[model samples]
Target: MKVLIVEDDQFHSTFVQEALVEALPEVTEIVHAANGAIGEDEARRGEIDAIVMDLQMDQRNGIEAARSIWAERPQSRILFWSNYADDAYLRGIAHIVPEDSAYGYVLKTASRARLKLALRAVLVEGQIMVDREIHRLQRRGTSLRTRLDDSEFNVLIDLALGLQDKLIAERRGMSLRTVQNRLISLYEKLGVISEFDDEVTLNKRVRALNRALVTRTINIETLETAHRDLETWLAGR
Candidate 1:
């Protein structure tokens, strides 16, 4: 089997290669791409059977590259190896991946045995394997822990980025009234409106964003993804 490794870090890429070689005897050709754009280019060549990709890269992020690749070849199998278990990354993956495609999400800190198992599960056995820690985080953040629905989370990010409701509505393709309602819900979910005193200088939107940051709900990685997505959206317009 031919496998492609899409990783920017030299040491991590080499480590993954060595692990693949050790675990899968049938993997004959293990090619490498420095970043997601190169990975997509290599994938378009049609020689690769499976891909092990890093989520964040300088040229292009794994999600965008994977979306482009899967648009052309929906059956392609991808293993996302990353250092983060951020909801933004997970949500982005869910949004783009084909319904029936085989994929895996493994943390970079996972053991070699775990990595090998994940690689085989996706490439050899055609199964999905998500890291337990990631699964736990997803569950915790989604179920009664944050109580911020996808729409609310999105509005929170927009608020954090200092976007007005009108601009957010335009960007998100939501009606202005809907954006206002979402902002109200977000303020309640983040407890910004109820928890803060009237004397607080910042408005509810700003307070909600600050609360999200303090609670570690929305983070730097999330903001980066938002920025990248905005750029992509602008380029497409």
Candidate 2:
């Protein structure tokens, strides 16, 4: 079987390659792509049997690349290898993954054996193998009390980036009032309104961001990624 490794870091890519060589004796050809953009191009060739995808990269992120790949080839098996188990990443993956696709999410810190197991489960056995921590976060993300829908999550990202509502609406192609409404929903789900007894006195944006950070709903990495993406968007606009 052929496998593709899509990672920015050469060391991590080699590590995964070595693990795959050790674990899957049947792996015949292993292709490598240094970033998600190149990975997407390689994947679209329709030659690879499975892919090991890194979450963050320069040209594109794993979710974006994978979404495009799945759009063309829905049956492609992919193993998401990443350092982050952030809610934003999980939500992004959930939004794009095909309903019947075989996929897995394994942390880069996972043991070699565990990585091999996940690879086999996804590529060979055609099963889903999400890390236990990611599964817990996924559950929490779907829970009604804490659930942040896609719209709310987009607003949360903008809020974390310190974008004013007007700027956010312009960036997101939504009306100012719609951005504010999403923020209100975000604040409610994050319990920001209740956390601050006097809502009139507190900055809900800051409070909600604090709550999100404390809950690991969003993190420094998520913000950094969003900031980079925002810059790219602005450059194109």
Each prediction's number of clashing residue pairs: 0, 0
Per-residue CA lDDT of model 1 for 60-172, tens digit only, reads: 88887888898888888999988877766777777778989999899998999999999999988889778898878667765674477788777777777778888889888
Backbone clashes, candidate 2: 0
What is the lDDT of every predicted structure here? 0.83, 0.85
Best by TM-score: 1
For model 1, which pairs clash? Answer: none
lDDT of 1: 0.83
Error of 2 at 158 (Å): 7.3
**What does candidate 2's lDDT look like per residue over 1-237, in tens digits?**
999999999999999999999888889999999988899899888498999999988877788788889888898999998886777777767767899899999999888889999988898889988888666756765576677877788889988888899999998889999998898888888887777456368878889989898877876546765777788988998
Q: Which stretches of candidate 1 lie over 4 Å from their true place?
A: 138-145, 157-163, 170-175, 210-237
Q: Judged by lDDT against the true structure, how good is candidate 2? A: 0.85
